[model samples]
Each structure stands twice: as C-alpha cells, then as structure tokens.
Target: MKILHLFNELKFSGAEIMYVSAAPLFQKLGCKLTVANTSLQLGEYTPAFKTAGYTIIHQYIPHALLRQWKMRKELIQLIKEGGYDVVHIHRSDLRWIMSYCAWRTRCKAVYTTHSVFRSHWYSYPLHFMQRWTAYHLFHCTFQTISDSVDANERNYYHTQTTLIYNWYGSTRFYPATKEEKKQTRLELNIPQDALVIISVGGCSHIKRHHDVIKAMPTILKKYPKAIYLHLGEGNTLEEEKVLAKSLNLNQNVRFYGNQKDVRNFLIASDIYVMPSKFEGISLTTIEAMACNIPAILYNVPGLRDFNKEKECALLIPESTEVLAKSIIELYENPKQQSTLIQNGKEFVDAYFNMEKNARKIFELYTKR
Candidate 1:
C-alpha cells in the first residue's frame, strides 16, 4: 500500500514523533510510507526519518493567500500523481482542504486529531467545519490519540473515528541502568543527594511549564536540593524563564531547550510531572512512565487514559499547591514511589506498545 503522511510542520511534536516511530512499523508490514511536511524549515525529526531510509518531502507554505493556494495545488498534485492508496493528515487544520483535494482524485482520506479539544480561533471554525462536513470531504473516518478524543470526535463527526494511542520509543526510553542513571545525573551536574524533577516536551503556555516553575518554590521549601528541569524549547521558553526569575526560582528551575534525545534525562530524573493545561495522550508522559519514573499529572484528558490514578501515578488537580504537595508526598514516601514505579511500568508495557498500536493504524488504513 502507498501512503502519504501530511504533517503541518516538521517539529518533534507528539504527532510528528509518533509518525517517526511508526513509519518503520508500517514499512516492516510492507507498506510504502512517505512523509510530506509543510514547514518553512526542515524539522528536527527529518534527519531521523532520512537515516531510517524513508523519503521525506518538505515544502514551505506561506500564510499569504496566494502562496497557500499554490501549496494546496502542489499537495493535490502530489497525492494524485503519487497514486497513494491513502492520504493521512497528522494535523486537523488542513484535513478539510486535503479531504477536498482527495475527493477530486477519488482517493481515500484519513485524519488524525493531535489535539483533543479545540483551542485556537482558527481551530474553532475548522473543527466546526470538520465535524459537520467531514462525511462529504474527509470521508468521515478519523483517528484520535486517546479514548476521550475518539469519543469527542465520534460525537461530532458521527463517523468511524478510532483510538490509536501515540506510540513511544519504548526500546530506547526504558528504565535506566544503575551505571546509566549515575552517568546521566553526573552529566547533568546533579549531585547524588539532590532530587531531580523533570518534564519533557515543548515549553508552551498550553503545556504549563510556567505552572511547574510556579510550584517549584513550594517544592524547594521542603527539598531545597530539588531541581526542576523543564526540557524542550518553544515560544514560551522566555516567558517561563521570566516567571521563574520573578518567583526567585532561578537556581532551582533549569530549562534545557529543545533536546533531540531526552531518554537520558528521563532515566536520570526521580520524578516526572506534566502540568499541562490540556493534552491528548502526552508522548512525554508515556515516555516517562516507560522509564520507570513515577509520574505526576493532572486528571486531564490525555493523561487520564493511562490509568494515571494513585496506583500507576499520582494524579492531582491543576493547582500549584496540589502538584507541589503530591510531589513532596511521593518524594517522602519510598513505598508509594515503588508502587507507582511498578504499576506505571506495567500499565505502559501492557497498553502502550508502539508496534501493537502501529498495527492498529495499518488496520484502519486497510479497513476502507
């Protein structure tokens, strides 16, 4: 089968990361996979795909009306001439337009919603059009990253939307060895006695890296040697830095912007917290749990799907005190930490296997 994966940008976002991880699985199953990314610059994961021997198509599409029209024409031409069996969109924004183009060629189209809820002004209208007109344009089939997202889209599109959990690089992101953990901590300049709390993903307002920084003072009052590492860079990196400075957490809060490999950091950390405003089965949260690190996340959409209760993880409300208190409690209680480690790893290994979930996508593709 010939498949074209249309991504909005080439950044190492959750959806893009999933594509990078799942492309090999699809190829291993005898499907021809091509990644076409619409972004001004080549994405971080572009090289990874190229190194893995996959064809990557990068086209710069400007926001100007005329340039967008030109890009859309080119996209349609690529799908039509490439003779792709399916055109899958990783971002929801362009699904309507792509669906229309697919319709012109009579090609089957599929869309994956990287976000569970609509947040932007553009998304509000785009989502409305998708939910209402998908049958006519998008063929009414959708893929969501979580159960909550699947239900939300099913209620709106009333089509055959399915849940395909975001696959992680479990082989690389597994639990750290004793020597590996010590080396990573030493590399990061963390003392053996210090408590390291980490969060991996883009640093954005939606991700609420600021809230993690806000809760740092409280965490430090109890564990002064505690260091909060916010890995990954975004527009909000400076904003979070300013907030950290104002809160006098400059020493405690450390921002490592845009890391290509976060496995070492994940394995080295004592705790992983994803204090996001919202999510759709966060890749970082899964990666953390795969590393046997106790995760603390809010009872939000994405994280909730992972059985992120007290058994597997420390689920809490989106309060600074609540997050800090949860962290302190978990840090102080070794027994509870061990339970979370054991159960969270079990949950992740059982439910979030990348190969198994990638097969589900292939099944969705062939179902049509």
Candidate 2:
C-alpha cells in the first residue's frame, strides 16, 4: 500500500525518530512509505528519512490564504494522480491542509496529535473551523499518542480519538553493561563517581530546562560532584546555556547539541529528568527507562500519564525546590532508583515494543 506521511519539517524529534526506527518493519509489511515536507525548507532529519528508505518530496504550502488554496488544489491533484491509499499526518499544523487534500482525493486520512495543545480563546473560531473540516468534511481518523492528548482533544474538540501509545526502539535502547558504562563516561570526560543527571530533548520553554538548571544550585550543595548533561538543541539552547553560565554551573553542566546516537549518552548517565511542561508521551524518558536509568519528571499532563499505569518515574510538582529535593533523594537512595528502573523497564517491555505498536499503525492503514 502507498502511504504518505506528512510533516511540517522533519527534525530529530519523537515522531521522526519513532518512524525511523519503525520504517523497516513497515516496509516488511509491503508498505511503500513516502514523507512529504510541507514547510518552506526541508529540515535537518531529511537525510535520516532518506536512509530509512522513505521517498522524500516537498509539498510546500504558503501561509497566505490564496496561495494555500492554490497549493491545496495542487496537492489534491497530486494525491489523486499518485493514488496514495493513506495520507498519515504527523504534523498538527498541516492537519487541515492534508485532511482536505486527502479527502478531496478520496484517500484515507489519519492525523496523529503529538501533544495536548489547543489555541487561545481568540482562535477558537479557527480551531472549530478546522475541526469541522477534518471531522465532518474529511472524515479524518485522529490518533493520539498518549492519554493526555486523547483527553484534551475530547474535551476541546469533542472528538473521540484512537489512543496509540508511542513506542521506543527496544533493540537500540537497553540496559548498558557496567564496563560499557564506564567506558562511555570515560569517553565523555564525565567522572565515574559523579552524580550524573541527564535530560534529552530539544531546548525549549515548554521543556523547562531552566527549571532544572535552577534546581542545580541546591543539588550541588549536597552532591558537589553532580553533573548535568543537556542533550538536543533548539531556539532556547543558547538561553539555557546563558542560565547555566549565570548560575556558575559551567563546570557542572555540559550542553551537547543534537545527538545521532542517544543510546551512548543514555548508557553513560545515572538518571534522566524531563521537566517538560507537557508531552504526548516522552520518547527520551522511555528510552532512558529501557536503558535502566531512573527518571524524575514533572507532574504535568503527559508526564503524569506515566504514573497512571505504575510509578515508572518519580513524579514531582513543577517546582525547582521539589525538583532538587527529588534528585538528591533519588541519588542517595539506590533501592528506590532500582525500583523505578525496574518498573520503567517492565512498562516499556510490556507496551512499547516498536514491532508490535508499528503493526497496529499498519493495521490502521489497512482499515476500511
């Protein structure tokens, strides 16, 4: 079957990474996968998509209403001509555009809501219009990667969505050997005895990287040799670095930009923390857990869902003081750390095998 996955711009983010890991399985299912970049410029992960055996194409739609209409016509025409059976949209921004185009071409439309987000009150009209177009006109199938996203969409748009949990690459991310961990730390110049805390994702305001940095001062007071490894990069990266420098945390913090192999870093770390304001379901957090690293996440919507099934990670309120205390407490208590690690590993093993979850998605494509 021909499937076109639509994205605003491919980045080293959860959806992109997940799809890359699942590409081989999809191809094995006799699926021809194509990725369409709808943004003005093709993004950084374009090469990765190419490597994953995706047919890459640009279907740029301008921001202007008239130009968007024109481009919509072109996209619809292309979809009909190409005879794509499914247009699976991973980018929320392109939901209306892709849904309209796919529906016009009589192709099945599937959109994955990657986060629990809705616009401001002023934009409610626009949101409702898009919802009407997608649900009523296009008959698009909506998929939510987490319970939070499903609940949020139901509450806001009144749309019942299929809840498909995001899966991690189990073979790629697993517990590291003691010797491998030591070698990895040695390579990264991290002290073997130091308290290593890592958060892996793009630097953004919603990620609340600054909140973690704010907590570092208190954590340093107790564990003087504590280290923070900031992985991934974004617009707020420089700001996070500035905050780290201002707090005199240059010695304690290492800001590493987008990484190709997060497994190595995950292996080298002692703990994982994601203070994200929200998430559909954090891929990094699951990966860290699969690697047998304990996690401390904020008690926000997406992160809180992790606590629902079982206490996979230590969930604390969105406070710098609580964060610092939790980190130190988790550090000092090895037994609790082990419990969290074991629970996390069990959780991921039970629900997050990519092969199993990816087949569910492939089945969605085969649906009438």
Write down the TM-score of every candidate.
Answer: 0.91, 0.96
Q: How well is each residue in 213-320 modelled by candidate 1, as lDDT tens digits?
A: 888888888889999988987788888888989998878888887687788888879999998877877888888988989999888877777673447878799898
Per-candidate Cα lDDT values, in order, are: 0.79, 0.89
Specify the highest-TM-score model's number.
2
* 17-101: candidate 2 lDDT, tens digit per residue: 9998899999999999899888888889999999999999887766555576668878888798778999998877678888988
Could you give me the TM-score of model 2 versus the true structure?
0.96
Q: Going through the candidates in order, what is the number of backbone clashes in each?
A: 2, 0
lDDT of 1: 0.79
